[model samples]
Target chain A: MIKNFIVLLFLFGLGMIFSALLLGYTPDSELNLTGRYYAEHTAQDLGAANIVTAIIVTYRGLDTLGEVTVLFLTAAIVGMLLSTGAGKGKSLQRKLSQSGELLTTGSHLLVPLILLLGAYVFINGHLTPGGGFQGGAIIASAILLILLTDPLYRFSHQLISIVESISGLIFLALGVLGIFFAGGFLDNRILPVGELGSLFSAGAIPIIYSLVGLKVGAEFSSMLVNFSETEDS
Target chain B: MVTIAMLTGFILILMGLYGALTNHNILRMIVSFSVANTGVNIVLVAVGYIHGRTAPILNEAVPAAEAAARIIDPVPQALVLTAIVIGLGITTLMLAYAYKLYEMKGSLDISKFSELKW
Candidate 1:
């Protein structure tokens, strides 16, 4: 009972500390210097209507690259750990999972539409709030739906791996292209900024976002496949 | 409103931390840690919020010239976006580790794996 009381007291202390911090925090009534600068410059400088996208893809492109690499490494580590235990050459093997006809047909119909929507999301990323990560997750969720509905359905390891590698390579090549053509590595100023808010504007942002979307999708699908094909499960 | 969001985030973090500290099952601990992660993301985004402001996008709703005065911080949002992805990576890695532990010992209770306990 004393121990329980101590835990409660500790928790209450923690909650009070957090509440104090929350109270002390002043929500900005005005745009601060960094915020103001990014807001003013993003559209004119990057030719991207979506300031967030400009900030994410061009201003902080290196961080995004590192983020993608971290995901890639995670996927690789998961695949390695699972592959050794789940047995060799069986990662891509199909299970005997059967589904209702409605689910099967619905998945077949929905898959292409989901892929299209994913493409649309990344393509319009420079003009909209959605971007590569969101679109990639959507596409991966579509794959997940199929995996759930049809457990026997086998995703081609070769195709997914090829897509993943190519996209990463393209992203790196685009960054290198930045060094030769623009301000620095990952710079989006290589091509003409073009008309603002247009589909073809934002230089390599949309293209880079599309590649990121594909790579993220493939990596997620690879991880899901690894989880599904485990030996003990 | 921003304060409310921040408060909610802090509450979530506290709850998640409590659950993680008390949970004996490895899976539950992972779930709790993920909850804590989500709380952190919400707090990060909340910290960047401003009063009477729109998103940092330059569209018809928010004109380009007026954006400096009307938009919230984009840097925090960008940082949070990357943090969210990295959080997922770490969670998945922990899950894989949990799975390996379960497979090795045929137990999910973290207490049972206290081989290094002094």
Candidate 2:
């Protein structure tokens, strides 16, 4: 009872702090300096319709690289942590009952469409609200559905690793190319910025983002597969 | 409207923190942490909201020339995107750790593992 009281007391104090912040907060009527700069310059500088994409994929590309690396590390660690003592005595495993026909058929029908949508989202990252991370998550959800339908199914870890590696390498290579061919690292001006709002505009952003999408998708799929493979152990 | 969102976010953070503090189950704790993570993300995005502004996308409706006056901040949105991904990574790591703990002790109760307890 005393422990619970202490916890509640601490929470009450934290809530008081939060309420103070809330009461003092006021919505900005004008864009701040950094926001003003990006808003004013993104289209003209990067030819990207989506300012957030331009900021993430170009202006702050190195940070994004670090973010992807962190995600990779997380997936790798999860795989390493869970793979030990897994899949032993496969012959002794109990057979899982077959998934319902409706689920099987639905997953079959939805997987391809979901994959296509993920591709579309990342491909249009420079023009739309969605981007590499969102698209990659969407693709991972498709893989999850497949696993759901067939619990015993095993995805090709080799294929997933290969996709992840190649996309990461290409993403880095494109960033390097930006230094030689464009103004700076990860600059989207390697190719012509093109007319704004066009599919091929934003120079290297769409390509880089697409590569990021594939890499993230592959990494997430690898983690999911590693997780599912542990079910037998 | 922005105030409402921020208020909801703050409330969620408090609720999540309270749940995390009180929960004795590892799984429940992980779930509470996720709730708090989401609340943090919401507060972050809400901080970037501007009065009477559209998204930071430029098109015919929001012309490039007039973007500064028309759009909300994009930086916070980008930061929130990163935050969400990192949050997912952390949640996954916690779940994996919880699973390993469960495997070790065959229990999900936090108090059962007392090796680190003083």
Candidate 3:
């Protein structure tokens, strides 16, 4: 009863905070200075049609780098936790029931298509609503499909680690290259802005996003692999 | 209106918090936290939505020169995207922790693990 009372009190405090914020906020009729600046200068500066991509990849590249690192750290920790003998491995001598042949065949057909779509999403991120993170998740889900249907399927841990490490290295190099070639780190001016709205435009932004996509995909795949390796999947 | 969305998100967050605080199952608590994180994402996105403008993209539809007049703010959307990915990572890590806890104790009850509690 005391715990419930305390919880209700905390919730009431939270509710008060929300009401205060709601009372204070006013919808701006015009873009504020930062928004206005990004809106006006993003296309001209980054040559990317998607302003969000331009902001995420160029204006705020360091933050994205940190976000990717957090993902890497999570995957690493999960890997460590699930490694042999790290967690209690009960010897359950039971085999998982086989998935239907039709389901397996359907997943086999759909996996490649999903992978292709994931590729398309990240590749076109500079021109559309999607980006590296969304694309990476889609790729991970495709791998998840295979894991669910094929009980005995095992992705090569070595291969996944290799993909992850190489992409991360490339991402770091791209940031370092920005320091030398561009105005500063991740300046997006390193390459010709090119014509706006073109697939090959946005200079290194698309490349960076693609690298991020690959790294994220690999990290998520590693996590899935870790989770599925348990005695009971 | 934006208020409606924000209100809904706030309610979801409160409900999630209540669920997390009251639930005895570790997995249920984790799920409640995820729900709260989702509420946060929704609030962040809704806070950035403008009345009638399009997304902050420049093209034939929204010209480069007049983008400020035609588009919603892109900063919040970018922040929310990053937040969502980080949330996913954290959720996965928490689940792994829960699984380890279960493996060690053969139980999923949060109340059962009182060794660290002073």
Measured by lDDT, the strongest candidate is: 2
Candidate 1 DockQ vs. native: 0.76
lDDT of 2: 0.92
TM-score of each: 0.95, 0.98, 0.96
lDDT of 3 by residue, B1-118 (tens): 8898898889889989999999999999999999999999989988888899999877799989889999998989999999999999999999999999999999999889999999
Query: What docking tier does model 3 reach?
Result: high
TM-score, first chain, each model: 0.92, 0.97, 0.93
Model 2 docking category = high
lDDT of 3 by residue, A1-233 (tens): 99999999999999999989887888777787988889988887789999999889899999999999999999999999877574333423446788999999999999999999999999999998988999999999999999989745778999999999998998898888889998888677777889998888999888889989999999999999888877463
Greater DockQ among 1 and 3 belongs to: 3
Error of 2 at B22 (Å): 0.8
Residues A1-233 of candidate 1 have per-residue lDDT tens digits of 67557767887999999888887887778778888889888888899988888888899999899999999999999988876756554543644657889988999999999989988898898998889998998899899888888665667889989999999999999999999999999999888899887899989999999999999989998988877767432
Q: Which candidate would rank higher by lDDT, 1 or 2?
A: 2
The runs of at least 3 residues in candidate 1 whose Cα sits more than 4 Å from the true structure, single-residue gaps closed, are A1-10, A88-97, A231-233
Compared with the true structure, all predictions reach lDDT values of 0.87, 0.92, 0.89
Please give the lDDT score for candidate 3. Answer: 0.89
Span of ten consecutive residues with least summed lDDT in model 1 chain A: A88-97
